[model samples]
Target chain A: MTSFFIYKAILVVVVFGIMLMAAMYSTYLERKVAAFIQDRVGPNRAGPFGILQPLADGIKMFMKEEIIPEVANKTLFIVGPCIAMLTAIMAGVVIPWGGELVINGVPYVLQIIDFDFGLLYVFGVVSLGVYGIMIGGWASNNKFSLFGAIRASAQMISYEIAMGLSIIALIMMTGTLSLREIVEFQAGGTGSTWNFWNVVYQPLGFLLFLVCAFAECNRTPFDLPESETELVGGYHTEYSSMKLGFYLFAEYINMFISSAVISTLYFGGTNFPFMNDLGLSQNAITILGTLAFFIKIGFFVFFYMWIRWTLPRFRYDQLMYLGWRVLIPLAIANVAITGLVMILTDRI
Target chain B: MKSLTGRAKVLDNPKMTFKERIYLPAIIGGITITLRHLFKRKATIRYPEEKRTFSPVWRGMHVLKRDDNGAERCTACGLCAVACPAEAITMTAAERKPGEEKLYREEKYAATYEINMLRCIFCGLCEEACPKEAIFLTDRLVSTDYARDGFIYGKDKLVEPVDKRVDVSKRQTPNVLEFKKIKHYRHNR
Candidate 1:
């Protein structure tokens, strides 16, 4: 038990470090992607290929002035970005990074926590993600920030419904709320029964979930809250120094979490097909699974950046319309169709 | 009426069809175009380490000329100052002493010359006005400076270095060279 506790502690630290590093580098990747899309060379001076740009940026963010509004609610203003970063880091706990690792004849799960209701736990924490934005925006005493806060809250709420519906369909098919079991259920046989990868079973659900994920992360097209033309810097408009850094970091971490969730729920998480045939050792397979998982996460991150540069922001009306009218209805129809198909096939 | 060039068409803002209204296909098309551009050659020159070739006749920073024998070409005739639309050029003429024949080609030479770059329009009118082939615009831009007074380029900034040559021959076209030759011939006559 003591050894297991030690393992868990190490895993927690590792996951936290990975989350922070990934968030930091996401900013660099965002700039590079934007530059590429526009046919310009981005930030290549700091280090080789500008890989150290994020480190430079972090240092710069740290060195900046931390200004709080004189008339603002100082306590909430201070707590806002702290809450944002905290919530952003908290969502990765239940995500299974790999299958298992056996060290000295003791098997250890690669995930930090594997609660039975892992899906609900992630959703619960993510829903609280809005409080950070709201508090920051409201406390700023700026009308633009307040408007952004309101929009953000409304957007998150509207999209959460469709997102929940989409996940509900997946839950019905998998019959478990645990993310680990969902991955296990999707792990198909070597011969070609590679039957899982929930995307095959729930293509429409995946699409709806993906669109909802974009909104949930407050990414482009759905990024009306932070629309520079409208709200300046939006929720973090008055935030500066590391406080502002925390808000931006929280956003990237949120993107990372959403990508992880999507890949786990639909793309088979860390389960690589035909691994048994390769005859790799158990520990080797675990390592390979983690690598495969990162590759999937990387692709999704790229997709986020790709679509961001590709698409323009939607009008506020269009955003609400899509969330309520388009995504919700599609998610419902997907759930119905999935239920009907499962019933007809007697797989329920 | 039809366009003389067969390219022009009537402009119309037609209603979007169902497929177009969805916008997915158009978005995908835009993404494809942008993706294609991702691999295309970038148009920027990156300034310091790399430079784009300037056009042969490109007018940039001013350069007071020197003949191949390294004698100053300006005769302090003030034609360039007179032709300057901005009136940015100012010069003080001094008679060339007998011993200074190797230094100054003409009997009269500009003792103190200055061109306020902030006021100059960079239209190459001064180059066109110079009868002595003394002034030409070279393919070097005036660098940025903090003080407004820094923009006032004196003879030290404008003149060609003695040991190292500054080439502005490309800017003197055949017509201009012939015109200079004729002007010199008329001056001698």
Candidate 2:
């Protein structure tokens, strides 16, 4: 039990470190991707190919003068970013990094927790993410901040419904709420056993979930909350120094977590095709699987940036229309179709 | 109204079709376009490390010229000062002593010549007005400075060094060279 506790503690630290590092680098990658799409070179001066740009940006953020509005609620202003960073990190707890690792005849799980309601835990944490923006925006005592916060809350709420409904279809197919079991269900490669990824079973659900994920992350085309053109920095308008940094960092971390969840839920988390046919050792397979999982997450993160640069932000009315009318109905139809197909095939 | 250039596009407000409304195909097309650009050659020159080459006839910073014996060619005739539309040029004339013949090509020389670079429009009027081919605009850019005084370029900043010469051969067109050979021009004679 003591060893198990030690293992869990170490895994927690490692995972937390990876999440922070991934978020840090994502900012650099975002600029690079944007520059490339526009036929420009970006930030190659800081370090070779601007690899150290994130560190410089972090230092600059920290060195900036801290400011609090005279009319602002100081306590909530401080708690806002704290909550954002906290909830953003919290969602990563349920993500299954890879399969189990056996060290010295003792098997250790790569996940922080394998709770039966792992999917629900992620959903719950993500829903709570809005409170951070809301509290911060409201406390600022600025109209723009309030507007951003309201939009964020409404967007998250609207998308969460469709996001949840889309997942219901996947959950029905897998018959498991635990992410680990969901991954395990799709274990074998495309061979004799033929356990395909969940995407093959829930293509429309995956698409709906993807759209919802973009909205939930407040990414572009769905990024009306912090629309710089309209809101003037939006929820973090009143924030300065590391406080503002925390808000931006939280967004990137949320992006990283969203990408992870998308990969785990639909793209077969750590499962790779022809994985079993390789006849690799359990430890080797686990390490390679972990690597494979990270690569998939990386691709999704890049995809997010690609879409961000390609599409313009949706109008507030357009956003609501798409979320409530288009996505919700599509997600419901997907769930119904999935149920009917499962019943006919006797998958239930 | 009829289009002047005959290239005007007609405006329309047709409702979106099912395919357009879905937006998946358009999104994919945009993604493909950006992907192609990602692999295309970057348009950036990465300035400081790389600079674009200027045209040979590009008029930039002014340089005071010298004769073959390295004597100052200007006789302080003041034609350039008169020709400068921006009133950027100023000079003081001084009589060249007998022993100073090696330094000054003419009996009279510009003792204190100055050009206010901030006021000069780089119109190459000074080059056009210099009868003795004493001043020409070179292909070197005037660097930025912090002080207003720094832009008042004196002889120390403008004059070509004895060891090295400013080449203005490109600016001397065939017509100017042919006119110089006419021998009737007092400076040419």
Best candidate per TM-score, number? 2
- Give the runs in model 2 whose Cα sits over 4 Å from its true position: A190-192, B1-11, B179-189
Off by over 4 Å in 1: B1-16, B183-189
Native contacts conserved, per model: 0.71, 0.79
User: How would you encode candidate 1's per-residue C-alpha lDDT over A109-183 as one tens digit per residue?
Assistant: 999999999999999999999999999999999998999999999999999999999999999999999999998
Q: Positional deviation of B22 in candidate 1, in angstroms?
A: 4.0
Clashing pairs in 1: none
lDDT of each: 0.91, 0.93
C-alpha positional error of residue A158 in candidate 1 after TM-score superposition, expressed in Å: 0.6
Docking class of 1: medium
Worst 10 residues of 2 chain A by lDDT: A185-194
lDDT of 1 by residue, B1-189 (tens): 878998997899999899997777898898898888789887767888899999998889999988878899999989899999999999999999989988999899999999999999999988888877789998999999999999999999988988877887798789877766664554322
Indicate the residue-level lDDT of B69 in model 1: 84
What TM-score does candidate 1 get on C-alpha atoms? 0.95
